[model samples]
Each structure stands twice: as structure tokens, then as C-alpha cells.
Target: MHKIKRDDLVKVIAGKDRNKQGKVLNIDAKNNKVTVEGVNMITKHVKPSAGNQQGGIVQKEAAFDISNVMLVVNGTATRVGFEVKDGKKVRVAKATGKVID
Candidate 1:
């Protein structure tokens, strides 16, 4: 399993959003990018369509390099590490050495 997954809280470690924190909205492992809520905000210009009655400029979260974020556990920003417990691999928070689900 990947260290970072959906709904995970993460802190931006680099780029213009440095120090910002948000939940993981999506993950593109193949492209090595992740979309975080309220991070990497971008504007999209769209025309009115059946799906969007008043389509106009909209704000959305954009994907950024996964390496730019660190998983947050218990209000602490920590690196994730994999460890085997009871023959099952689990995520461990480096700062507290606590299991993350």
C-alpha cells in the first residue's frame, strides 16, 4: 500500500504552498502527484454547459509533486514508514513511532 492515501492529512513542505495543510483529495501514483484540499488552488474557465448552468471561472485544487507533502499524524507532521506488525504491513508515523491505521 502507498504511504499516502485518500483522506490523509498532509502538510505542504515545499513550493508556494509551503506549511499549508489539507486532506488528501486524490492521488495519481503513476504521475507521482497528489491533490490536496485547499492547496494548489487554480482557476478554470469553463463555458456554460448542461452540467454547469452558470459555468464560469472556478477555483479548484491542482495536483502537485507528492514529495512536496508530508503525512500528518496527531497534529504532528511526520514521514511515513512501513513496518510489519502481526504479519501485516502498517503505516508508522516517524515522529511518534505510532501506527497509522
Candidate 2:
């Protein structure tokens, strides 16, 4: 199972947004990238179209490498570790040694 999922609170560990926390908006498993809310935002210009009534510059969230962000655990952002428990893989919160759901 993927440690990061939609709606998970994540902290940016690398790049310009480092140390900032946001909710996970989406995850792209095929590319191993994730888009966090309010992080790595990019602006795009679009022409007026039927689907879009107001066609103009729009700010959108961009996907960043999954490795660049870390999950926040127990009020702190920490790296994730995993181990086998009861014949199943379980995620461990590195900072607190607690099992993460």
C-alpha cells in the first residue's frame, strides 16, 4: 500500500516549498508524483472555450515527486518506515514508532 494518499496531510521536505504542510490533493502512482494543496502551484493560460466560461490565467496545483514530501505524524513531519506485522506490511511513524494507518 502507498503511504501517501489523497487528503493526507504532508509536509514538503525538498524544493522551494520545504517545511510547508498541506493536504494531499491527488496521487499519480504511475509517475510516483503527488499534488499537495497550495504547494507547487503553477499558473496556466487558457483560451475562452465552451467548457470554460472564464478563460484566463488560472492557478493550478502541480505534481511534485513523492519523495519530496513526508507525512506528518504525531504533530511532526517524519519519514516513513515499514515492517511486517501479522503477515501484512504496516507503515511506521519514524518519529514516534507508532503504526500509521
Candidate 3:
């Protein structure tokens, strides 16, 4: 299982958005990139479309390398590790030794 999942709160550890925290929006496992809410935003110019009547400049989240983000646990950024408990494999916070999932 991946340490980061959709809807997980994470902090950007590197890049222009470093130190910004946001929820995971999407993950592209094949490209090793993840999209975080309100992070790495890009502006796109689009003509009017059927779905969008006034499609002009739209701001949207952009994907960045997954390695640039760290999982946030208990309001602190921490590395994730896997452990088995009750025959179930779960994620643990390396800094706190607490189960993350």
C-alpha cells in the first residue's frame, strides 16, 4: 500500500510550494505524481465549451512528484512505516510510532 492516499493531509517538503499543507486530490501512480488541493496551481486558457459557458482562464491544481510531500500526523509532518498488528498490515508514523491507518 502507498503511504499517501487520497484525502490525506500532507505538507509539501520540496519545490516552490514547500511547507504548504493540503489534502491529497489525486494520485498518478504510473507517473509517481500526486495532486494536492490548492498546491501547484496552474492557470489554463480555454474557449467556451458545452460544460462551461464562460470557459476562460481557470485555475486548477497541478500534479507534482510524490516525493515532495510528507504525510501530516497529529499536526506534525512524519515519515510513514508499515507494521503488522492483529494480522493486519497498517501504517505507522515513524516519529510517533502511532498507527496512521
lDDT, candidate 3, at 77? 100
Q: What are the runs in model 2 whose C-alpha is more than 4 Å off?
A: none
Better model by TM-score: candidate 1 vs candidate 2 = 1
Q: What are the lDDT figures for the candidates, one per model? A: 0.96, 0.92, 0.97
Per-residue accuracy of model 1 over 35-98 as CA lDDT, tens digit each: 9999999999989999999999999999999999999998989999999999999999999999
RMSD each, Å: 0.7, 1.4, 0.6
Q: Write the per-residue lDDT of candidate 2 for residues 20-94, one digit (tens) a residue.
A: 999999999999999999999899999999999889999999998999999998679987889999998998998
Which pairs clash inside model 1?
none
Per model, state how many residue pairs clash.
0, 0, 0
Clashing residue pairs for model 3: none
Off by over 4 Å in 1: none
Candidate 1's TM-score reads: 0.97
